[model samples]
Target: MEAALIAFATTAATLSVTVVLALLEFRRRRREAVQARREQIVGRVLDTLERATRAASRAPIVGWWAPNELEYALLLPRLLAELPEQDNAVATWVARRIQHLQAATSRREQVAIGADVAAKVVQWGR
Candidate 1:
């Protein structure tokens, strides 16, 4: 009886560990997929905005959109919600400041804005 109990306990322990590891791996893969989706969305946004700016004969990082306006900021939530993924909080946050991207007057400011937007890729799938 004692040997049987020990064998059963050992099997249970190994199965539990296997289950936990599998769960963790699934979580990690899901996270990576979400991040990839967000990066794709951001890329699309920047590309579209750049094209629009150029077509309008405006500079991408300067004077394409008005700067520091509370009114234009209101469009962010709508834009984010309209996306296929409604839970994209990082994209929502980015949309909040996106209009102002073209407001940067200097090259340094443009670079900073670019870097800040790029860094949001790691924030979350949501």
Candidate 2:
């Protein structure tokens, strides 16, 4: 009877340890998946902003705004707000993007000026 009890206790301990390990592993994997998804989203946004900035670089002197540049400028703030603040790298990247886009306000192009005004109008209002 003592031997049986010992065996049962050993089995229960092992099972408990295994369950704990499995839970830990699951939590680890879930965190990694969330981080991976966040990276993918950030990458997609970077590609889009890159394309828009490229188009905006060729902005005309007189217009309400160059559509692509305007889009890039406007999306900066929303994207900054949308990303999780817990990730320092993401926050740093977004800060740099905001700085880069701020150059629009300094450009001589009318489209750039319009982009600045539009961004101010839409973003500053809130």
Candidate 2 has which clashing residue pairs, if any? none
What is candidate 1's lDDT per residue for 1-126, written digit by digit as tens? 999999999999999999999999999999888777666765655554444333334454554363433333443554476456656665556765565565767545655565565555334434
Best by the TM-score measure = 2
Report clashes for each candidate as comma-separated counts: 1, 0
Candidate 2, residues 47-72, lDDT tens digits: the string is 65555555556645533454555565
Q: Whole-model lDDT, candidate 1?
A: 0.58
Weakest 10 consecutive residues of candidate 2 by summed lDDT: 117-126
Q: Which sections of candidate 1 miss by over 4 Å?
A: 58-126
RMSD value for candidate 1: 7.0
Instruction: Give per-model TM-scores.
Output: 0.51, 0.56
Name the regions of candidate 2 deviating beyond 4 angstroms: 59-66, 73-82, 88-96, 99-102, 105-126
The count of backbone overlaps in candidate 2 is: 0
